[model samples]
Target: MRFQLLGPLSIAEGEDAVVLKPSKPSSLLAALLIHPGSVVSTGYLLRALWDEDQPATARAALQSCVLRLRRLFTKYGVTGSLIEAVPGGYRMNADADTLDLVRFRTLVRAADGAADAESELYRLKEALTLWQGPLLANVPSPMLHRDEVPGLTEERLRALERACDIELALGRCRQVLVDVWEAARRHPGRERFSEQLIEALYRTGRQSEALSEYRSVKGRLEEELGIDPGPGLQRLELAILRGDDLGPAAVDQAVPLPGRAPLALAEGPARPALAAAPAPADTPAAALPSAPASVPPVPLPVLPARLPVPPVPSFTGRAAERAAINASLTARDPGAATVVVLSGAPGIGKTALALQTAHDCQEGFPGGVFILAMTRPDGSSVTPAEAMADLPAPGTAAGRILLVLDDVTGADQVRPLLPAAAGGAAVVTSRRGLAGLVATHGGTVHRLSTLEPEESLELLAATLGPARVNAEPAAARELARICGHFPLSLRIAAARLLTRPGLRIDDCVAWLAEDLPARLSLADDPRMSVPHVFGGALHRLEPRWQEAFRRLGDQLGEHEGLLLSSGTLGGSAEAEEALERLADAGLLEEGPPGPYRIHQLLKIYARRHAREWNRSRTATAPH
Candidate 1:
């Protein structure tokens, strides 16, 4: 199937054009087609469809639109393999040949490296012909407001400029002067179009008029962009004023000014910075053009800003923690980045809290939020240096900025990524306490623990509203209790209840009250169950700590009481250190000179790990 979005939205299979219903689904499908092979989150889609006045049934309505689009593909005899859902959103997988905009760019790149001026002019005009009218002329999509649209709009203008360059080379400058002047008037802030107008005026023997045009554009640039003109246009103005030479290279040098990139464009309030042009895949003997003499010194440095991933809507509680994180990261300082590490157990909401805080504090950072997942999906670690290489350099952009390092295992993993600039801040979430990160960066560390009983119940209510939970107060309390006030387990239980409509709180309570071994195998959730969420922390324990945790679990289960002293830890210093390590990791709660109690579910996980470790050691022991 071929999708045409360069003009009106249309999809065709073979030679037959599929008629799409003129409604939100058609517009929504058009929006998704803008960026092929990329995830467009549900949040963005909703905003696009509704602007600010979203309906209550927006999620369901959006899903219906996607379903209808897929059905339309099936109806047209094309397999519905084009669009699919990702974890957070949906993505379309269209290629360059099938998409008009992509084909246009390919043709432009071919013209950029053509051998002769005639062929270059031909290719440029061919590419320009693809645009029938203003982009997506008949499609009423909210997508026109997106950031990528300006870059898409640049394609036509660039093809026009390249054609003008070839025309000037063919001694047709006199024929293009009127068009160039009109284009320059329409887009006064664009340095290239204005430069073309100046060249045409100079070629027509209006040297003084060309100089006057350059002076006017220069003043506009200073007032609007807070910067001077680029080297290319400035040099052209000088050459015109002095009547440099009517040489062969005169056309090629029209827009190339020293100290700036040849393809640089003037940035306005709505426009992003223009990147240097890419070299052609297959180039001729003559190089296309030299890169910038150096990085173009714009008044404001370009920042590779990215949106922070948001948590699910059910996120609740942690009011104090959120306030603390916001206050620290948003503090007014002109020295070094304020580092705040959220140390907690696995599945204890550390990453979620940090992400939510980053979203909340986004307004404080003009450079925008930069989020890095410290661990890969397969569970391997990413070195700090590798992560640092992906972010903007320290002290490069303006205003406050945030760098969120999620699921960190060690301080050393994020050391290189830490900024030395004062206006920068980082929120690092880790199971292990990053004391060294705080010490080196002069920041604070907050140890995150499980929610309090009221807070845990509130989290459950946030997931399954108060109406349902209030109807079964006893069952709700019982369910929360069995989950040990653990945020991860409560969320999982809520999910089960959400999926099963008739299932009540008592059903969840019965599910949670089952024996540990039997329940672990029977739980419907593989991702957020008690053992799955809490078990990984056990394996992270060192040998001595593992033994202590296992023995402690055994004693707690056997009614040996909650408090442990030197006697229960086998009088071993290694065991004592291991117990403290477990406490610091949020697997155990620390107390003064006694046994540290753990959550009821955590005790079970510890006991399981302890028994497994002992069994392995015993099996390996000499017979």
Candidate 2:
């Protein structure tokens, strides 16, 4: 049986075609063929088929589609169980030789293992023959189509680049002249293609054109990426200028860009496409193999310029915290991969602080200030691998990058994206203190807290005019206290004041001070409410850590709900772990004198939950 995923979706046994009905189920089958031997998640399929607007009966509909696909395969072939259900989703089982994608990759790997240029070139040409047209061309799915197509294209591109390398190795520069030159011109940042083009131009008695190409490439790299050409590129330019004895094989033995990436067998797992490099005109068969003319240059698009998430509109007061982040991340440390973790409770302005700091840090990190918002809309987290892949591939200037990871859920989620060299900096904001990050490296943790009294006032004035705040000095002070000096609450209070023009500061304070619910409610916005904002952080905690949070909510000392001890918890180790977890999560704070404490408003919320736990336990008690 032969299955094709290189272009469209086709299945055949010998010469007989196995026709497939073009419906949703057939589309599902086509999608499965792209990632054969891998588990395709149900959620991924739902998004691929219907995009984000999934129906209520989406799972049932998807299952029915899968069963239909299974029946179709069963009817078509005696091949047992092509598609089967797995724990999380479905997997399509197929031999490597049966799928074109698998066969193409196998051929490329074989080329990489070949001992000589002739063998390598033959294998590469054979691999290129597998691509009939645009991959998955018939599928009407934006999710799978967009996500999977580019990777296949890149793989073909890599094979072309390798083929050119082999042709140059066998001293057949003229054969690939027009094709490789057009490729280098169309695709910048790829020094390998440029190197081949330069060598070919020089060998054909166009030394000036070769030198001109080098200058053009150098200027483009600096202008587009703020990077210098690699050392090998510089050396080539120097050799060309001085008329050094250069050979065609120099292009093949040359180093890749950045001079840091190893000459590995493969570039991670991505498969980038290549522009067709056709044979040059008037070239002798002895110098270059006879091939079709080069395909016209198709401009490869550059990655879009990253526009970072804008800072909060009413951002105010974090002088000390801002300085701390600046000192840790954007300081003049030449080759140190530093990390700074900003830990605090929910709605405490960790994100605001980190963002504001990044805005002021543009000069130091000329490479770029990239932010990856770590939390999802459902209050869950993006997997570490996905987050890592989403980040722009590090460039030559990766050393000067100031990567801001906002609202991180866990340390493991970011481990893959951490700077490999000690030349970059990362600013991580999370409810849980990522102690593992700093403990493993020379990073620091800045435990953020509620704004100081004066800072809180400044925030109010920043939001509402200074004239209004000055007019009601006493009321303004009272309101700041009532809002617990928390940034989110303060902003909400300010938002409310702006919305209701006739409302007074004193009236606002009194209304809020009326009851616990009133005190917590700064505005009608769900994100503004004290409980809702704090609940996001608390909801992520384990049951045991949550209990520990409840127990430590009230005032410290004798009158507190539960004493801080192993006797209250299960054992000494259990109590210690619980305390550490709460402290790390920023639920436990230091009291005025020195015992563990929580925010005044958060304390009330926690006590309520603790009482609920006790009540539920009492109600469900066995007779």
Candidate 3:
């Protein structure tokens, strides 16, 4: 059976497509196919089906879909099981090569690295040949649909761009005119498409046509963005006007722009729409392969401007830590093809550290894609299948993107989205160690431990400065200990200090140590605490483990609880299994050499909440 998600979600049994019942199931199946071989958790499946408002029997619904999928597989003449039920979710048991999308991505990466033009062209063609239509076509899922449309659209654009690149490499600029012109007509507002068309026009000695195309694009930008044409296109126009031979070397030159982007040939200022071009009397407007004259004049829709994600601003401290991260990244080939797992308790700065590393290594991986997943209402992670469906295919500018999957306790749900080591690297952060998944994929793991005392002090100093922090060294140390040296707590504590400009360090420490429940109330920001960030992860734990977490907060040491909950503690394996679940959610820390502890702030929060519940019950009891 061939399952397609890179385009329309289709399941074909040999030569014929199988009919899928319950269209919702087909959509769900499609979402999984987008990231085939990845584990998709139950919670994510529900969300893809119902989002925030899950049906009463959501689990049953998901199981039904799985059943339908299995039946379809059976019809395709597959033997035993195609889907495997794993710890937290389901895994589609197939190699990457079996899926067309995976095959396409693999080919693209190979093409990007190829030295020969003919080989690169063949690779690109192979990649492009896999796409059938808009992904998840006819599917009625909000997240899946939104992602499917944009994601596949981006991939199609990339394939066209790469094809142009290969053509240019072989000195076939003139030959690209037919494809480029058609692309320009179809996507009139896409500056990249227009830029390539102009370049091809100029290279083929159609100087006037190239200048007219540039002017047309300029008009579109000015009308749309109220800005002028970007540097590369403008410069190309000048060179063409001056009769300068803008050979291969010129194409490689940077496009001058006000921003820092290396490649902005298509990211220039948006222009206003031009009056529709009049069709030549002799030529039909829209030519097609079948009946050239009968092809209708199709109006091109405006390409929405893709705003870039804001760059990470300079952050404070941990130079050595940052260097260590960069070293780990650079350790693997041209760089490591491994998934660097940053596991630690909530608010220990795992996400922050990973982001910083990603920021630092931005230059190395030009075409890298960065993604941050939000937790679902239920205690499961967002599935890799769903996430992959949403991610735009890597663009030329964003090549070899560093894939950072933050909050990755649900490895089963996300492992499919983890790209194989091709032209990119992946970093996954979790509260618990995903050793099994990492080992299975031959990936290297990096554990993000709590901050050191010195590092903690440095964080405070950065926020409050050396003078204020030094004024009360004892208070600083006490504050660090109270916060368990977790980066989130430190930042919050430091932020509070910054607000009260004249507050003493002792006063801040006293506030944190004492009256913290009352002072750091959820009244201000609902998600300002570690507990807030760990919502879904916490809910997913079994009841016994959840209870054990609360009870052990005051008693367990960091490593002790970690080992106990990570299934290493001695007992009937079931008890250890319970602990393992807690460890994965960032609720319990399982450090090296044994021991486990909750995030210091989380411990305090849960204890107080439990105490309040107990108090309320006692007060309301009838005598």
Candidate 4:
């Protein structure tokens, strides 16, 4: 089964479509899409759903989610339980391609070790082809933002490296000059790109231009890091001086340069001794944007300022769920239909599913997927219009375009990012329900949930190794129980096991039970944790609302997952207003109707602080 989590969550078995439930259920499906091939425990799932305040019937509700997913899979002729139950939770039994990040990583890995020059070039091209857009497009989950943001940056760098490699290997150094020039302009502080440009210049017989490029990079490096060029690069410059041909020679190729020792390449062609070829004045360097003469090595200008790097989220499990999501999205709708939302709580894998879905639909969206990540400043999500403004302007004839806007908690923030026409759909992800927005835009809202038991077990097996999983199913189940079926938690636990090869199943279970908080604490990384990211909202809340938040945090599961609602901490009207405020800030997630939960990690952090407040209250109480 090919799972699609790149866009709207969907699963497809060959040509068939898997139907997912709407709104809340769709959110659950997105959560399941994150892990792809691992088990997600029920506790984690419930906490994701309720944001720490699980319902009395959360178990049954989760079961219903599993049933709905299974039925959808069955309708599409999927024989096995795509959403299956395991000892303590569920898993989506599928492959990595169900998630775009996994597929992208796979291609990247392939490109990394590519041998033959032609094959390496081809592999790089293939790897680049997979990037329709940013991973998960617009949807930004803590689980995804933490992992995907870093991955995206790394992938971009990799793409640049491959492009440079191809240009050098193909002896098309002249062609890449303009591109590298632009890249340097865009990323002024990056010395690697500058190095590539210099190498390309050297290869093109422009020794002076190459030296100029080097000087620029050197200046910038000195300005930024207070250092000189590294040895490899200094060696390259020395090689150039010794009349060494800078053509596509491997690093080890022994080539004599003026005063330097002959460097050797493992399999490089011999370079001709010397040619007094004049620098091509009309070359790309000449075409580059001119600067005042005083600006030495202008091409290597220092960056204006450091760009803000958002947190990268890491998601675990949900291979099958992602496949189902992809299958459903790729499946043709009767009419010219578009617009799918992968909605779920933070860290529940909405973005992960969305990414897989987008990847699956790459062939469908020739215009390529445009992504706008919605970030919150303080407590409020950035508006849609603000996000949309950053996207490349759509062409007059927008054909087969997939636009993604992620983490849109408020309607206003989401409204601007949407495409003007309904011809091509925009896939949006959010913690808050967007029923009104969906109706306004003629879009489909799909809720995502956590994994099923079988899916969970499969994940455990994959993470812990099948041999160990098979021997201790009961232990796995108990571990899953403590994990709460959350993909992130499950992966953390599984990763711990993997790292400690000799870790026993029962020992893991015992550790979880004896120090559940500590075990869960280990799962908390500020970069990947939803609560940490969303805590900005708490800082912006009113004092009364903040107090109410603390109470809600302390009494999460026992209080029907109160979210400034239900008057558990305050009056109904006060609760309602607070809930709205929190939702707008992306701090609180809106569930089915009256239900609400904080983002999973946020909830834990919030509760921790809340408990501290409670202790303070006890101390302050009068006898």
Each model's total of backbone clashes: 5, 14, 37, 102
lDDT of 3 by residue, 357-446 (tens): 876676676554455553432234554544553344434233455677777756685566655335567778877778787767666666
Compute each candidate's TM-score over C-alphas: 0.51, 0.48, 0.47, 0.48
- Give candidate 4's root-mean-square deviation (CA, Å): 17.4
TM-score ranking, high to low = 1, 2, 4, 3
lDDT of 4 at 342: 72
lDDT of 4 at 486: 60
Runs with alpha carbons beyond 4 Å of true place in candidate 3? 1-321, 331-336, 374-380, 394-398, 521-523, 534-536, 553-573, 591-603, 616-623
Give the runs in model 2 whose Cα sits over 4 Å from its true position: 1-304, 308-312, 396-399, 420-422, 517-524, 553-573, 590-594, 612-623
- The local distance difference test score of each candidate is 0.66, 0.67, 0.60, 0.56
After superposition, the stretches of candidate 4 with alpha carbons farther than 4 Å from their true spots are: 1-337, 376-392, 396-398, 420-422, 512-526, 530-546, 555-565, 579-605, 612-623
Q: What is the lDDT of residue 22 in candidate 1?
A: 35
Task: Please identify which of the two predictions, 2 or 4, would achieve the higher lDDT against the true structure.
Answer: 2
> Can you give the lDDT of residue 326 in candidate 3?
80
User: How does model 4 fare in lDDT?
Assistant: 0.56
Model 2 root mean square deviation, Cα atoms: 25.0
Per residue, candidate 1 scores C-alpha lDDT tens digits across 379-495 of 557556546544666566655768888888787888877753346888988888777777777788888777887888787776665556778988988887777676777776766
